[model samples]
Target: MNQTKKYLVVGLGRSGVSAAEALLRYGAEVSVYDKKTQDEIEAPLVNYLKTQQVTCYLGTDPSDLGRYDAIVVSPGVPLDLPFLQKAKTLDVEIIGELELAYRLGKGNYIAITGTNGKTTTTTLVGEIFKNAKRKTAVVGNIGIAVTSTALVAQDDSWLVTECSSFQLETTEKFHPVVCALLNITPDHLDRHKTLENYAKAKAKVFKNQTEKDFFVVNYDDPVAYHLIQECRSTIIPFSRKSILEKGVFVKDNRIIVKDQSQNEIDICGVDELVIPGQHNLENALAACGIAYFCGISAEMISKTLREFQGVEHRLEFCAEVGGVRFVNDSKGTNPDASIKAIEAMKGNIVLIAGGYDKNSKFDEFIQAFDGKVKALVLLGATAPKIRETAERFGYQTIFDEKDMGECVKRSFSLAEPGDTVLLSPACASWDMYSSYEQRGKHFKSCVQELER
Candidate 1:
């Protein structure tokens, strides 16, 4: 038997639980701790962990840091926490679930990170690779613990990971052969404390990369575009507007990819993509660049681009009731994301927004919503804040009901046949719904109920 070492796993969320399970599978003695009591965690996972015989610490002080070889932290746990700080002082190697997965996986990984469009880009890149018949897995911040997947998988396969700033905060030697920074915006300001700090966390994706690695970035986003000059890896860039010397871009309705020597490959046409929105087109361009780096064929890239239905909660069309289209964009959890969603609309919009504020500044949304949104229905914890900001910007804002159902009804009442009722709240959903998916599902349900 391999020597049984002890491991401490902190946080019982998806990533943390996955990490603990992986450690148990590796023949390590695992002890899991969560801030919530045993009763507070999802009943199924808690019961499952008990069956696995993992020692548990529920609703206990996290000061017991001296008993483990390493600490496996979930993304939700901050590195600067009192217990975590003490663990570091006691010489325990603190690592995230992503780091754990990368160490154990047998495949060459392609990592994607940005404030927005990361999930779409990561999933698209993985799809492009899979369409080429490559053995690939998409995991990380989006879903599935990268560390857990890595333990069971070979390192030679392609691991397309959707890394977030929280996961990036604890990463050390976890390097990727193909890395991308999609774009940077003011997001997760509450956790990162400031815009600069949040951006700095995102930039860490390429921190330990080498010359053999390729760093692909968006040259259109000023924050992300300018950071390319400081990266040490061979740079590949994608743009919807700017001309890249090497990488991917659109020209004359065709999506073009150029090699380091300026050789070109026409992947697809701009109008060929199934998913709408300028940001998604940029996402496609970036994913195409990653596919090219991973040796995926242009033909496969084109096919996937044309066939992809897009990820849910990202401008997903719910229904068209009496000429009014309902869109569930509950994934728009920040000001920039909401602004982009609003900008994507063609006709007047009845925009339903606001949730847990996350300390977001509203100037951008105010500027973007100038004449786009016909009316605003604000709800959740940040509804008052959103209303205040909208009123301060000289726009008509409605202080509406408690949940998404009521908001949807109000939006339908305010909208006409040609207008749109969009639930693209520019804040986190924890204040009302359990997650963005729940919020989106409620919107879809309300729309369905209306249809009947």
Candidate 2:
């Protein structure tokens, strides 16, 4: 936080750029480094940073680790990299864009983190905040870098941030007034290296939260709930299962928030929510818990839940052709997430899956089908592995396609009337696309083309 200290930003992505810009604006000496070359990473932000005379080390490693006071790393940059390890050895501070933003910004943050439903919950939280007439900004892994909004955040503002495990990993003194952990499942194991390590990263979201602050937790998830046992925050829980004496939960088809006195405030009916899936119901519960603890009205929370159309690429309806409906769930980039997507659909699904593997096992995902999935269409790097898993499970009706277009066409052909052509890849899209957004957009376009 010292204005005169020098800072280094690793990675040239959005978070990296925002961190670099924020440091410059804080009157600190700033430098940037990325494994990608200059031409490989270019945007108005990158060009603007160059105009600021910011030092950039592109397509190369930093030679000296001791020059900068701290390194602000992007979520994608591995902290175990050689130079980063060297920096750690020299006693240099290492933090992420989220930490930097927390230090620089002035706001009450409702930080949401989990293996799945983060985007949906964060979006719902933002909507609830907006409905309450609070000054709010939606940032972090929901797409906008938190640092980009850091300077403008006032003390009265609310930053409804979507914190990823990667962002949470580097947090130091990054505290949110309301922190929610939706659920933790096997995800990003390729980066974190283990499920418990991944859970540890998620557990950091509530690390700095004081008892005065509220920590929203998923009581139904044993893995996530166990980690919160040592948390210092005033715990607020939401569950799809047992009825709690306090916090938000569903009972008799209604979303209810109970106080210490066992008084309940009815939010809305479960069937009234615009988004689908039991997972989404959990997301709504978490959001409601966060908003209620933050002083948002039950009416506003219920209204927002009823009106939320859901974020794009997450169970989004694309088109219907020849009685076959197409759904885009590109955000289902892990097995646990795809399983939720599968459970949300109605009719028999001809599913298009497979992408970049994150060391995820597809056994649970495949088993979730339970005769609901009619056929499988595979693509991307994880295609072979997924196909093997599917065959071993006795779901042999599968077709391996070279690309998204072929996969979409094949899935549509395999679907009968009243069936859903669902693109719910249980792997990340890095092997075939820059991001899940790019992959989802491509799937939607291919489906739209079918109508043409």
Candidate 3:
């Protein structure tokens, strides 16, 4: 990257702010823009940007983008916006935060993307690398912006980044040495408008990889499997069912990997995993494949798997109140993710679900209930829609609450002694909270407040 380059960073979100900081650190001039007003923006961020001498355009779009060498867009900003279209006409390079990080960072990257399980898989891979005593940073959609650590990354460092469709959509040359796609399900339909467009965006992770690079895909997911045909990277697959001739799978209750020589290596038994659910087993398999390719020993992979409990907000056990377990799966913000959460439950479930409606259908989620969901406690903007869907499925035990506290109480009331109260909202948390982490924390607080 040229030090004299001028960058226009659109969006004052975490990723955008990080990009501006990174650009300034690289000795480049940067101008930050956000649709939000100066007062609406956080005080700390505003003060920090001012200190860095970055130009700020708040509550409005910049009159001209041609002055900058390139425009860095945050994941939340839509590409179809009029200003972005104008930037395109100006022939100004428009790239995402991830792309900016890639352009400036020095390291081998292992990027994971899917509608679900990206965080768990990325974190697991990061743990494996760290356990091997490798320098690693887990970033992207998992929380920390990649730009935060990109400048400090060494050639030997491993960046386990969780790429989202939103980030992937704007990537042009953001390549990873190792990339994995957990599964592709209907999600972010409001943004992409179609599953094809969404999958295309996800496929961008491998768009710049060569044959020397590795792409780990989920063999069990048809969408993920189908994408293999378009990848130029060496394809490595992981499956929950069926043994593969040259990939990772479960055999005889053990996690097995088939090397390039067609030799079978047993990593560990499925029971050894600290994380619950068949979905996590798939995640473990993907992590194993990535670790194996990265030269991480099976023992290290098994050790990480055995000790890794799981990522927060994804089937995290909050507290057992009145003999009923309260599980917070607030990260299950989509139907497919919620389906996996529901399937992972053992006892009868009192499910607290529904949030911002992403125009997603509830038929599949309701079908997965399978008599295990004792009662459905709906909330948020999509409560009525989910209730209507449940009724159509002949499910009568459904309740709706206006807030998280009431929803938790309602679920607890519906649960029996041996039952589980799961807060697995099958929609995004934007309707009620800033992020899923916030929603998950509030749920935990509510559960902790339950009278013993």
Native-vs-model 2 lDDT? Answer: 0.92
What's the TM-score of every candidate structure? Answer: 0.96, 0.98, 0.98
TM-score of 3: 0.98
Q: Which regions of candidate 3 fall more than 4 Å away from where they truly are?
A: none
How many clashes in each candidate?
8, 0, 0
Q: Which sections of candidate 2 miss by over 4 Å?
A: 43-47
For residues 1-452, write the lDDT of model 3, one tens digit per residue. 78999999999878988999899988999999999999998898999889988889999888768888999999988899998899899999999999999999888889999999999999999999999999999999998999998889999998999999999998998989999999999998988999999999999999999999999999999988999999999999999898998899999999999988998999999998989999999999999999999899888988899999898999998888789999999999999999999999997999999899888998999999999998999889999999999999899998878898998888887788999999999999999999999999999988877864
Q: Which candidate, 1 or 2, has the higher lDDT?
A: 2
Name every residue pair that clashes in candidate 2.
none
Tens digits of per-residue lDDT, candidate 1, 1-452, equal: 24387788989888887888778778888888888997788888888888888888898855568877889888988778788889888999898888877765567878899988988898888888888888788889777678766776764678899999999987887888889999999888888998788878888788888888899999888898788767899888899997778889998889999997778899888888888889889899999988898778888889999999888899999999999999989999898888888888889999999898799988778779868788888888888888887788788756578777888889999899999999999898988887888888988999999988
What are the clashing pairs of model 3?
A: none
The ten-residue window of minimal lDDT in model 2 covers 37-46
